[model samples]
Target: MTYKGNQTTWDKLSPSLQQKIDTDLSGIRQTVTNNKTEVTEHLAKIATTENLGHIKPDGKTIKVDPATGIASAVASTSYYVEARQTAGTTTYDVNIPDVTAYKPGLTILLKLLENNKQGAASLNINGMGVKSFIFQTYAAAVQNAGELQGGRVYQLVYDGLYFTVIGVQWVSSYEGGTDLANNPYILPSYGAVGKVDAKVAALQTQVDSKSTKDVYTINIPLISGWQGLAQITREDNNMLTLYLDIYGGTRTGGTKIGTIPAGYRPVQTYSMYFGVVTTASGSVSPQGAVISIYGSGDIYITSSNIQHNIFIASSFK
Candidate 1:
């Protein structure tokens, strides 16, 4: 049967075309009316589109265009932070000098001071003072102690403390290292740093042991219960790996502070379910016929060159 737009008995259009037209128009209208509803429906598989998917796009948000009156472009980058180091040589003292000794652009150099020296070796700069900082080595003369050859240099400039270690390297470096060897530990730097409260706090259930790398599970009420999730085994040194299994599915992303000497945030990945229900006359592609579904986006969240943190959170229902 056919139904025309005469608002009565214009039986000229096929039912399938009518349905598809109805769906596409309805989507455009709904986007005009309410965004939250549209976003939820799109995410929940209630609504469908050709190339649309559930993706928190990089820098571009699923926002409405004020002038065009449709959901169009949105800001991309959100927050930033630098990943910290896990271990460093405790050869120098890390303490904050008096404010009088502080000067902008003046490089502050100091050591993280590792009391328990072992492994690749690194000092912890957690509770050190800010300002009064200097650099030295246990055995060799190291210039740019803030950055060294044996390891990395974690310098808390404002606090005047620093650590000489290389626990965290760039992800690209990790890939290169993997080409030579199959070790994920030689993977790269991870996580983020900076003053607290920079990004949105996604407080998860207080973990009992923060060092466990087994197949753990996280129960999120949003997803209805505890789902089997994989433990973050191959995380960057910054501790910025969030691995989760929700609704019998798995999603990997996270932002955490650790002992690495750099910072980074997880980039957003996209996945969408789309299809056409029926075909139109003279058209091969039908309505509700799924065309393509996948996820893709850039890796880095920003182009600051200066390192930053990787903050991430996810919910599935």
Candidate 2:
């Protein structure tokens, strides 16, 4: 029944409209015979507006508008996308389907494919323009090259401005030596979390099964006449160490020293040649010495001249 004026009597109103008042407004969904409680019962479920969320949207958060005092369900993007390798290193582009709107507090997880070169780095998430990373955990930290590494995940949060990098995972460049001391954003590994003293330290564990990591130091075996020791350790990310100080044997050039064993060899390749130069007074010259480590666990010391008590530890390409 259509109302012609603002004033209407109980008997004049149609039964259908009164029932609509019960179902849509009062939430009774039945014809009301009694008109005594009409005013009081009509106010039931007054807040049930079409703007309010009824259906549960998965990965969405219900928030209240401070200005209008109305609640709404918005896309939160509370999950992460699979690791994406950015085509560009300095400017990364990752496509996450769930990221539709660029609002404040919207966070995104990025898995990088290559090391971010030094200078500055930015992210273009879902083609949402380039946003430079204003990385900050404690103080204002400038973006450094190689800080955001490949095969690792990082979180970026929008603050109505630049996305701030508030977290950092372990710098897991096993054979590639990237230490954690420079990375002040170190946190616990694996899925479990402990009490973190700093906010940055609490965010490192995520998106990888590689939770266990360490440096291995194995002593290389020597022949009967060889007396000194040779130790190979994991030093830097993508780099291995081979330090040896052996003497007392009549060393032959281009000859086998001994096997370094299977587990002790570098994991990068089966066989690798390291043109190492060692300084040995009088016997072996640093210029002519060549070290060859085979994947078959054989280490050969090839030097035209012999040496004793040689200590060699320097940079290698």
Candidate 3:
């Protein structure tokens, strides 16, 4: 390139100085030409990996630091190889058109033609022998059936010995207390999974058999000249109460007014703390008798006494 400044001062110089300037200009031009030749030669040898274009005199892709040009090292992402399972179940027979031999980190897009039916599975790619497959990094964990579901696309990397899957949508062998053997796909993220039971929508499963607003049907024995009403109500608190007034004549101890259903019965004779009684004359005194409900669901006076109205509510297991 020519010098970027004007040569106006050259004409005003003494003849001898002008001669010197010309001589120096000639030498600079020669130097620049020689430098260009050396640079051109140096660049030609920098690199010429065609796939990454050669280091011509202009900007170009350079692959001098990896694979072919350099010593063993991680290569660029492998060529896209489409693999599809052709047959076999536990050990799938795969066809990866571009794969002839296994290479470390050789990743491929695999399409499963059949779902695996065993906890362990392997893939034999193009007769290259079987390579263990996994949906996760745990090589020791049971692969479990349906782990590699069919009709699904998965990315996998060949780690020399095994093909580690990039993963498909699965719950995994561990984690999630949910029972999904019947259905593995997740429900749409909307309402509670699988329409919730209306009775339990606002509560958890009452495994202890506790209930809300549980009314017990008691068998009342009809007594002459006795206007008695018995109503037992349980609020799931393991306690029963009388919500209606009970009027009865003097009955001896062990007289069964009624029996509660099996679920409402106690394990043993349970004395109720709220079975307070009053005489039909509406007199509240020591003349009243206490009631005890037995495991047989028998409800009766704990001891002999005149028929007293049980002004009731009870706390018992």
Candidate 4:
């Protein structure tokens, strides 16, 4: 709500003796009005929040930050060992088997090639970027009764982006199921590997959504009263002409009344400042004509860069 600056706070009171005190206070309201208007207008011009990332396109990409989370390189190839028994469990020192054979408990190297290049480096597994797991060495072996366990189960986590498994080619093999002399496993036995997506990938999608909402609220205050007389204007003293153009007849081009450039700058359109205003019950002239504001581009963001002019009712007529 607004008020005419002709009456002062004290003058509004009912007087019994021709005003308890004599004073010229009519202009007092003008000062108060101007003060209040300036404050509100100033508050509107403030930048609440902004998506600092939007200013730069590269900011959208996620880079490994060593200062925060753990940053490590993805493995080109990782291997694990698994042991089994055909007869009784024997305590034997085993090593990684060659890539030519297939034997239970034999360490097989899983090569996670990026962009088909074994030396290619990436941040996550699949196309979605999320660093939850990395390729590492694992060992599995079968144990004797009460000695340890039955058979060792090794787990290999190949977590990286852009690298999909084609097939596991056997490198080599070793001693067969048991201690038999004739039992011998060969090499080059290949197997199929399935691809799996990481959970961190899904979590990143959620984070982006929340970030967008936060950015929206931050720029709201910067665009307050966007369509009113507080809008940016040019020319030293053309208030009357500008006012007439905006609400004047269906005039077009530079001849229109409110023909000021939409942005705070003298020229050029900052996608953020280019928009049309929809008014419902607010008038530029005589009385009530509702005005609803809408933006075409990133108006809120652009509005923050412009200077706004707020005039109290007394400043005019």
| Predicted model with the maximum TM-score | 3
Q: lDDT for model 3, on a 0 to 1 scale?
A: 0.60
TM-score of each candidate structure, all chains considered together: 0.14, 0.34, 0.37, 0.15
| Residue-pair clashes, model 1 | 45
Question: Model 4, 139: alpha-carbon shift in Å?
Answer: 36
Whichever of 2 and 4 has more lDDT, that candidate is: 2
RMSD vs true structure, all candidates: 49.0, 23.9, 16.3, 53.9
Which regions in candidate 2 have their CA more than 4 angstroms from the true location? 1-31, 35-44, 49-75, 82-89, 138-144, 168-317
lDDT of 4 by residue, 1-317 (tens): 22344457546756742242333344576788899997886555443332111222432323333421232222123454433321221322234433223212222323321112112122221222321211232122211232122243333333222222222122223323454345466322222111113356667777877743231101121222233332332333322111211221222212211222333232223221222332333322222222212222122221221122322221110
Q: Write the per-residue lDDT of candidate 1 for residues 64-138, one digit (tens) a residue.
A: 234322222232111112322333532333333332333232233323332333323232222432222223323
Q: Lowest summed-lDDT stretch of 10 residues in model 4?
A: 239-248
lDDT of 3 by residue, 1-317 (tens): 23343568656667987677778899999999999998887676565444333465565435555435433335435444434444444566666676678878777676665555665666777888978775554654326364667777777777888877775433433334555675678443223342344446545555346544555555444343335676555545566554335675546766666666666666677764443456567765564566777788777767654454556655556
Cα deviation of 89 in candidate 2 (Å)?
A: 4.9
Q: Rate residue 126 of model 2 by lDDT.
A: 77
Task: State the weakest 10-residue window (summed lDDT) of model 2.
Answer: 190-199
Clashing pairs in 3: 119-144, 249-307, 250-306, 250-307
- Model 3 clash number: 4
State candidate 1's TM-score.
Answer: 0.14
Give every collision pair in model 2.
175-238, 175-239, 176-236, 176-237, 176-238, 177-236, 177-237, 178-237, 270-295
